[model samples]
Structures are given as C-alpha cells and as structure tokens.
Target: MRIAVTGSSGLIGSALVRSLLRDRHEVVRLVRRPSRAEDEVEWDPKRQYVDAAGLAGCDAVVHLAGAGVGDHRWTEAYKKEIRDSRVLGTAAVAEAVASLGTPPRVLLCGSAIGYYGDTGERAIDESAPPGDGFLADVCQEWEAAAAPAVEAGIRTVHARTGLVVSQKGGAWGRLFPVFKLGLGGRLGSGRQYWSFISLADQVAALRHILVTEELTGPVNLTAPEPVTNREVTAVMGKVLHRPTLMTVPPPALRVALGEFAQDALSSQRVIPRKLLDSGFAFEHPTVEDAVRAALRP
Candidate 1:
C-alpha cells in the first residue's frame, strides 16, 4: 500500500515509517520545507496548505505533525502554539485529502489521551465523554479539524495516544537518564494512574487502524493495563537496578512546569478498548514489559 505521513521525523512517525518500509509499502513524507526527494511533499500547516498533487493515489494518510506538548513550559504563547499546530495541521491534511479525486480509504489524525483531563483512577475508553481543561479543549479542536475528510466519506480515525514508553522521545526519554543516574522517583503523590504503551505497540496500533475498515472515530491507543506513577517508579527502579526513593511534590512540579504541571500530575487510566476489540495485540502489555522494551537495543 502507498501511504503518506506527516510528522515523519517524529518519534512515532519515524517508527511507523520504518515499519511500513520494512514491509515493502511505499511511503511519502510530508515536510514543512521545500520538497527534497521523490517521496517528499511540501506542506505548510500555519498557512493551511499542502501539495495536493503529491498526495495523489495514496492509499492512506496519517496526520501526526504537531508541537510537542511537554517540549516547552506552558506559557500562554506556547499553549496557543500547541493548539494551532494540531488544529491547523489537521485541517490542512484533511482538506488536501478531501480534495483528492480518489481520496485515501483511511485518514488517521493524531490526538492524545489528554482529551480526558484528570481522570484520576477512573478508566476511560473512546465512548467516554470529553473531560475538562486546556488539553481537552485542544484535543476536541484537533480532532474536529479533520471534518473535511470525514465529510468526504473517508474513514477518519482519531488516535488518542497515551504516554509512549520509549527512550527515543516523549516523557520516557527524560526519565531514562534520570533513573539511570538514580535520581528517579514518583512525581507528586505518585498515586496518579499513568496509561502507557510501548513504542512498538503504538506503531502497530496505527497500522491496525489504517487497515481496519470497521474502525472509525476516536480510538484510545493505550495498553490494556494502566499503572500508577508509584508503580511506574518501582518498575523503573527494578528494570534499571536503581533506587527509587525520591519524590517531587505537586507544588514543585507546578513551579517547574508552570501551567503544564497540572497535566503532569494528573491521572489518566486510559484503556484501548477499541484497539483490543479490533483484535490488536500488545507485545508489551505490562509496565515492566514496557520499561524493558524501552531499554532494549
């Protein structure tokens, strides 16, 4: 199959591209700058533009380009950056896909588990209603931006992903070194639940959604088992053979992360019910499995 993917340089996108290529599928990468190669297509999300011609004949399109949520302190400007990047980027990709004479069968738009803000110990699935807070609003707008593709009769799927368990990037990337240095511990009270997925499973789930015609709308991309922050801390120490005795209070996190701290300390026990019901299997089903997978060469 021929697939076009934005955010091809990002952690999840890069891995998905590699996996597709390994299976001999043709891949087109949408870039922000000028097209530099045969498989390159230029897109400007801020301008809401994409080279529609380059996207012709693609069997599917995965829109994952967006600003990293934790990459910056939650200044007002950065918050706008986060919302605009996803909403605008999705609109561009969806509009471009919708304009195609023969649009791709599937359009997978990136989303986040943050859509369910501060779920505490409550388990959430795609059927759950939207929660409150900054990220929930951003996520709602982000997914809604893909309406063009949906209106075009394309099979649109929202990948509401959780914290990926990979050392390559995301929150886990920062945790590895700290834990390796024996400074890792729980954040805040450590009672908050953390829904996480190994990098391999994340890529696989994306592929699953691409091919599964029956699946549409919002789908949670978390593991079957969700662990608490305290549990994650224990697993990290066990996997790294380090001590996990430190703790960062909520006030400290707020001081350090600004508005983002509330999210950092928030609890979300997300479940991949749709993915599981669609017969998607996880290679790393447990937090320990995820931690060990992240450490693998």
Candidate 2:
C-alpha cells in the first residue's frame, strides 16, 4: 500500500511510519519544509495548502499532524495553537486527498480520547457523546475538519487515541526521567483514571485501521484495561524499582501547568471497544506489561 502520513517526525507518527515501512509498504511523509526526498511532500496546513500532485495515487492517508497538547503550559495563545494545528491540518489533508482523481480508500484522521472530556469513573466507548472542556471542543472541531474526505465517499476513521506510553517521547517519556531520578509521584489526588496504550500497540492498531474496511467513524486507540493515576504510578515504581511516595499537590500542578493542569488531573477511563470488536489484539494488555515493554531495551 502507498501510505501518506503527516507529522511523520512526531513520536506516534514516526513509530507508525517505521512499522509501515518494515511491513514493506510505501510511505510518503508530508513535511512543512520544501520536499527534500522522493518520499517527501510539501504541505502548509496553516495556510490550507497541500501538494495534491504528490499525493496522487496514494492508497491511504494517516493525518497525525497536530501541536503537542502537553508540550507547553496552556497559555491562551498556546491553546489556540493546539486547536488550529489539528483543525487546519486535518482540513488541508482531507481536502487534498478528496481532490485526487482516484481518492484513497481510507483516511485515518487523528482524534483523541480528550473528546470525552473527563470520563471520571465512567468507562466510555465510541457510543458515548462528546464531553465538555477545551480539549473536547478542539477534538470536535478536529474530527469535523475531515468532512471533505467523508463526503467524498472515502472510508474515514477517527483514531481517538489516549495517553501513549513510551520511553522515547510524549508525557510518558518525561515521566521515565523523573521516576528514574526517584522524583516520581502522583499528580494531584492520583485518583483520576488514565487510559494509556504502549507505543507498539498504538502503531499496530493504526495499521489495523488502515485495512479494516468495516471500521469507520470514531474508534478509540486506548488499551482494553484502563488504570487510575495511582495504579499507573505504582506500576511505574515497580517497573523502575524506585519509590513513588512523592505527590504533586493540586495547587502546585495548577501553578506549574496552568490550565493544562485540569487535563492532567482529569479522569478518563476510556476503552477501545471498536478496535477489539474488529479483531485487533493488544500485546501489552495490562499496565505493568505496557510499562515493561516501554522500558525494555
């Protein structure tokens, strides 16, 4: 299959690209800079520009380009950046793909579990309605931006992802260092649920979606088992053989993370109902297994 992917340099995107290539699939990387290689396609999502010719004849497109939600403190400007990056980027890719004479069979647009807002103790699947908050609004718009592809009869799938657990990058990446140094602890009350997937499973599930014709609409990319923040901290401590006694108080989290602190403290017990129903299996089904897989050399 000829697969075109945006955000190819990002943690999840890079991992998915590597997995696709290893499986002998042709991969095209969408970049903001001038095309530097045969596989590179220039695109300017903010300006709603994409090189449609470069994407001609592509079999699939995985739009993963977006600003990192946890990369910076949530200033008003940064919040806008987060929303624009996802919405504008998705719209550009969707439009470009739809314009192709023979449009791709599948368009796997990126979504997030944040769409559910705070799930609290309630476990949710794709059947659940949208929740409230900043991320939820962004996700709603982000998914809606892919209307062009869906309207064109493309098999559009929204991979609503969760907190990806990896030692290499993402929120999990930052956690490994702090925990290794014995500075690891829970944030706020540590009672909030955290839905996480190992990097390996995240890539695998994405590949599964690319070919599963029956699967469309919003499908979560989280693991089957969701654990609380306290549970995750305990697993991290056990895996690292470090003490996890420290705790970041609510006031401290708000002071350091700004509005983003609410998201960090929010509980989301998300489940990958559609993925499993589609015959996908997880290599790391448990929190301990995921932690071990991520930390393994």
Candidate 3:
C-alpha cells in the first residue's frame, strides 16, 4: 500500500513514517514546501492549495500536520496559528486527496482528546460530546474540515490522541532533565485525571486504524485506565527512583504557561473504546510500564 504522510518531520509523523517503511509500504510525504524530490508532494496549507496531480495515485493519506497546542504562549497570533494550522492543513489535504484519480482507501486524520474538553473525573469515550475551549474548538474544526473527503466516499478516521509519552519528544523529553535533577513534581491539584498512552502504543493504534475497515470517526487513543496527575507523579518518581516532594502551584502555572495552564491542570478521562472494540491491543497499558520502556534508551 502507498501511504502519503503529512507532517512527516514531526514526532508522531516521523515515527509513523519509520513504521510504514518497515512494513515495506511505498510512502509519500505531504510537505509544506514542495520541490522535485522522490515521493514528496508540496502543498501550502497557509494558502489552502494542494495540487491534485501531486497525489494522483495515493492509496491512503495520514494527516498529522498541525501547530502544537501547548508549544506556544496563547498570544492572539499564536492562537490563530494553532487553529489555522490544523484546519487549513487538513482542508488542503482533504481536498487534494479527494481529487485523486484513485483516492486513498482511508484518510487517517489527527485530532486530540482535547476534543472532549476538560471532563474532570468523568470517564469520556468516543460517544461523549465535544467540549468547548481553545483546543477543543481547534480539534472540532480540524476534524470537520475533512468532511469533503468523507463525503467523496473515502473512509475518514480521526485519531483523538491523549498525552503521548515518549522519551525523545513532547513532554517527556522536556521533563527528563528535571526528573534527573530530582526537581520533578506534580502540578496543581494533582488529583486531576490524565489520559496518556505510550509512544509505541500510538504507532500501533495508527496501524490498527489503517487496517480496520470498520473503524472510522473519532477514536480515543488513550489507555484503558486513566490515572490522576498525582498517580502519574508517583509512578514516574517510582520508576525513575526520584522523590517528588514539591508541587507546581496553579498560580505559577498561570504565570508560566498563560491560558494553557488550564491544559496542564485540567482533566480528561478518555478511554480507548473504539480501538479495543475494533480488536486493537495495547503494548503498554499503564503509565509506569510505558515510562520504563521509554526510559530504556
């Protein structure tokens, strides 16, 4: 199968590319800047224009291009960039893929568990309605922008991911040094629910969705048991053999992260109902196990 991957340079995208290559599938990248290169399609998401001819023979398209929700301070411009990156990038890819002579069998779209908003201690699943907020709104529109592809007879699947725990990128990488220094601690009101999954599990879930014909729409890419923030800190401290005696107060979080402080302090107990129902098995079912694997070099 020929797989066209967008955001091929990103954390999840890079891992997905490697996985697909290992499976010996022909992979094409949906790049922001296009040039005469092998298996690369240039499409400008900012301008919302993707050359249809560039994706003429695609068998599947996995869209992972987006601005990091927690990567920037919530300035007015940064907010717009976050919203536009996902909405526009997805729209362009959907349009291009929809125009293909042989459209891909599946359009694996990217979304986040933030779609359910901050659910507190409530257990949310794919059946739960969407939440309202910055990230939620962005994810809603991001998933909605691909309606054209779905309407055009292509199977569209939204992978609503939770906190993807990895050693090299995202949150884990940023916290490793602090943990090593014995400075790692829980955030404000560590009782807040945190839904997370291992990086290896993320890749496995993606492959599962790609192969499962019956799976489509919003699929929560979270672990079965959602742990609290305090539990997470305890497990990390245990695994790394460090003591988490300090705490990051809410005021400090608000000062350091601006509005995204809510993201860190909020809760979302998302479950992988669709994935498990679709026969997808998780390699690391708990945060401690995932962390141990991630910390292993």
Candidate 4:
C-alpha cells in the first residue's frame, strides 16, 4: 500500500515507517521542508497548505504531526503551540485527503489517552465520554479536526495512544537515565494507573488499524493490562537491578513541573478494547515485558 505519513521523524512515526518499509510498503513522508526525495511531500500546516495532488493516489494517510506535549514545561505559549500543532496539522491533512479525487480508504489520525483525564482506579474504553483537563480538551479538538475526512466517507480512526515504553524517546528516555542512576521513583502517591504499550506493539496496532476496515472512530492504542505508577517503578527497578525506594511528593512535582506536573501525576487506566476486539495482539502486554523490550538491543 502507498501510505502518506506526517511526523515521520518522531519516535512512533519513525518506528512505524521502518515497520512499513520492512513489510515492503511504499511510504510517502509529509515534510515541512523542501521535497528533496521522491517519496517526500511538502506541506505547511501553519499556513494551512498541503499538496493535495501529491497525496492523490495514496491508499492511506497517517496524520501524526504535532508539537511534543511533554517536551517543555506547560507555559501558556507552549500550551497553545501544542494545541495548534495538532489541530491545524490534522485539519490540513484531513482537508487535503478530502480534496483528493480518489481519497484514501483510511485516515489514522493521532490521539491520546489524555482524553479520559485522570481515570483513577476505574478502567475506561472508547465508549467513555471526554474528561476535563488541558490535555483532554486538546485531544477532543485534535480528534474532531479530522471531521473533513470522516464527513467525506473515509474510514477515520483516532489512535488514542498511551505512554509508550521505549528507550529511544518520550517518557521512557528520561526515565532510563534517572533510574539507571538510582534516582528514579514514583511520582505523587504512586497509585495512579499508567496505561502503557511497547514501541513494537504501538506500531503493530497501527498497522492493524490501517487494514481493519471495521475499526473506526476512537481506538485506544494501549495494552490490555494497565499497571499503576508504583507497579511501573517496581518493574523498572527490577529490570535495571536498582532500588526504587524514592518518592516525589505531589507538591514537589508541582513546584518543579508547574502545570505539566498534573499530567505526570495523573492516572489514566486506558484499555485497548477496540484493538483487541479487532484481533490485534500485543508483543508486550505486561509492564515487566514492556520494560524488558525497551531495554532490549
């Protein structure tokens, strides 16, 4: 299949691209820069511009372009950047795909489990309504930005991803160094459930969605078993052969991370009901397996 992908340089995007290539699928990377390669398409989301003709014959398009949410502290400007990057970029991709004479069959847009806010001990699925919070609001708009494709009769799936467990980037990248140095510990009360998926499973589930015609709407890209932050810390320590006795109080995290602290301390027990129901199997379903897979060579 000929697939057009945005955010091809990001952690999950890059991995997905490699996975597709390994399976001998053609990938067209949407870039903000000049199209130096034959498989590249130039697009400017901020200007609300996309080369619709360049995306004409693609079989599918995975829109993953967005500002890094946890990359910076939650300053007002950065918060706006986060929202604009996802909403604008998604709108551009959706509109572009909608304009194509022969539009793609599927549009797998990126989303987050943050839409559920702090799930506490309760487990939630795609059937749950949107929750309240900064990230949750961003996710709501982010998913809604794909209305053009949905309205155009395209099979649109909102990939509500969870905390990805990989040594390459995201939260795990930061955790590796701190945990290796024995400085890693649970945040807040450590009771908050963390829904996580290994990098391998993340890509696999995405590929599954690309072909599964029946899987549309909000599909949580998380593992079947969601563990608490305390469980994750224990697994990390076990994998690294280190101690996990330290704890970061909620007040200290608030002082250090500002508004972002709320997210770090939030509990989201997201479940991949749609994916599993669609017969998608995980490579690493447990925290121990996820941690081990992340550290694998």
lDDT of 3 by residue, 1-297 (tens): 888888889889999999999989999887767657888888889999887687777778899988887787899999999999999989988888887778989999999998988899999789999898888888899999999899899999999998888878876667667777789899997999989899889999998899899998999998898899899889888988988988999999999999999888999999899998988889899988788878876
What range of 10 consecutive residues in model 1 has the weakest lDDT sum? Answer: 119-128
lDDT of 4: 0.93
Clashes of each: 0, 0, 0, 0
Model 1, 1-297: lDDT tens digits are 999999999999999999999999999999999999999999999999999999999999999999999999988999999999999999999999999999999999999999999998988898899999999999999999999999999999999999999999999999999999999999998999999999999999999999999899999999999999999999999999999999999998899899999999999999999999999999999999999998989
Better of 2 and 3 by lDDT: 2
TM-score of 3: 0.98
Residue 193 in candidate 2 has what lDDT? Answer: 95
lDDT of 2 at 96: 93
TM-score of every prediction relative to native: 0.99, 0.99, 0.98, 0.99
RMSD of each: 0.6, 0.7, 1.0, 0.7
- List the candidate 1 regions with Cα displacement exceeding 4 Å: none
lDDT of 1 at 27: 100
What number of backbone clashes does candidate 2 have, counting pairs of residues 3 or more apart or in separate chains?
A: 0
Over 138-221, each residue of candidate 2 has an lDDT whose tens digit, in order, gives 999999999999999999999999989998888899899999998899998899999999999999999999989999999999
Judge candidate 4 at residue 255 and give its lDDT.
90
lDDT of 3: 0.88
* Residue lDDT tens for model 4, 157-177: 999999999988988888999
Q: What is the lDDT of residue 81 in candidate 4?
A: 93
